[model samples]
Target: MTAAVDTRPDTAPRGIRRKARAYVALTKPRVMELLLVTTAPTMFLAQGGVPNLWLVAATLIGGALSAGSASAFNCYIDRDIDRIMKRTQGRPLVTGEVTDREALIFSYVVGVASIAWLALTVNLLSAALSLGAILFYVVVYTLWLKRRTPQNIVWGGIAGCMPVLIGWAAVTNDLSWAPVILFMVIFLWTPPHYWPLSMKYRDDYAAADVPMLSVVRGRSIVGLQVILYAWATVACSLLLVPVAGMGVVYTVVAAASGLWFIWEAHRLYSRAIQHVAEVRPMRVFHSSITYLTLLFVAVGIDPLLPF
Candidate 1:
């Protein structure tokens, strides 16, 4: 592992600013933003309004660190394959901005720091959840499942869903049906959110020898699965309306966004059936992000209203 280094010569970023960006790139900040999006809304719902500002700050920082640590470990672990996939070919590890030893050491230092920070600033439960999330992502998702099965993200995506539970636990230090249902909502949302992206990058995965669902399954099959998961994701989103006593605001937004999400999934399926030249799976992928943002935006907003 210590001998691992970026092999690409022409693509590596130069200068200090670019190098700094490379270090940050290891954390997969874009992915971290999406993960953190789900966290705050769950906290807002747990508190029935805005949670303590300090608690919110602490939770976000801790969550970010934990996510960054896990992502860095993934970058380190997948360094070899990252070089093969066109979409991943520009990663910091593949570009040689960061050494394998440096990435591994960074992963451990940040992982431990996040656990300690959350434990001191948030609560033991939140810290515990952070630790569990990091461990699960590295052990279950990256190492154990990612290369071995096309169903990898199906089970491994649970690590991404932990933010809901962590957010709720940070506020109340207890688990309930509400957070559990929210967790399930994300669990269901994962495939629809990811499969489309995988579909677009099927060739990349094929080159990497990583059997993502879109690589292993036919386009129509992937589309059908996306639709199924979209339906389930929508169903789970609505569960919060009754379980959490969510008001009309949340219920209406969730139902409408869910319908939109389902529509996109169906459109993707239709294109697959017709064998469209360019399926544009990214349309569905982009819509999934929009759907989650709108749904969680409602989660935060609904709690602020009296209803």
Candidate 2:
């Protein structure tokens, strides 16, 4: 007698993969990448050269988890507004790819795990800083500032600056002027880096009743503010050369890339002031990423160079 053969397709693996991707999307991986970019280089600078590979790896992992926790919490909190904004409508919570309850649980789990991971693998200071960052982003920025103030990103941006301090503390188990200056660099850079994206999405923000600077202010005023912040960012970046005793690589890269960033900001201002139909705010948005990447790359490289 021949045995009966069953031919049923396996759908479990596919369903699991889809759910995994939705959970990762709740973490905002792109934003996490930018935060990690600042972490390792700050570690390198803190070490005054290439740091211990294990320590660097541990710190980066902890930092990523912390950032992921903050972003997931933001997604859960902003789900209502996110649905109304075209730019955010595709987010996992907004798209129903992840439920509000699942996102909240994931955030708390990841947050507790990050603090524990840092405390065990890195140091208690790094863990505390990571916890502070999570609280600032979730409580201060998401709950208090985001809906009420156009200056939300300005103060909210403080959470983003914690990685530099955390990186330094991981290496030295303490803080100093070098990390503080780097902290300020990111603090000043956040406005110029974020405002342009807000400009492009001004209408979506307005519709959501989120008071981003670009939504409440005129384009020309926003453009001018961008230019001002861009200048300040570049200026603060220069302070690292003296504060950290950086060499030719960082000095040249910071100066040249900063000039390019300033030029992009000014071009946007010119367009905004002219009342041009298309102000192309994204140009500065992309330029800011390039500037920060180049500056941090130099940060990582300068310590290794024999100068």
For lDDT, the strongest prediction is 2
Q: Which regions of candidate 2 fall more than 4 Å away from where they truly are?
A: 1-8
Worst 10 residues of 2 by lDDT: 3-12
**TM-score against native, each model:** 0.94, 0.98
Relative to the unseen true structure, what is the C-alpha lDDT of residue 25 in candidate 2, on a scale of 0 to 100?
92
Task: State the lDDT of candidate 2 residue by residue for 214-287, as single tens digits.
Answer: 98899999999999999999999999888888999999999999999999999999999999999999999999
Error at 147, model 2, angstroms? 0.2
167, model 1: CA deviation in Å?
0.7
Show pairs that collide, candidate 1.
none
Q: What is the C-alpha lDDT of each candidate?
A: 0.94, 0.95
Candidate 1 matches the true fold with a TM-score of 0.94
> For residues 1-307, what per-residue lDDT tens digits would candidate 1 score against the true structure?
5888878675434576787788889999999999999999999999988899999999999999999999999999999999998999889989888889988999999999999999999999999999999999999999999999999999999999999899999999999999999899989999999999999999989989998999988999999999999999999899888889999999999999999999999999999999998999999999999999999999989999988
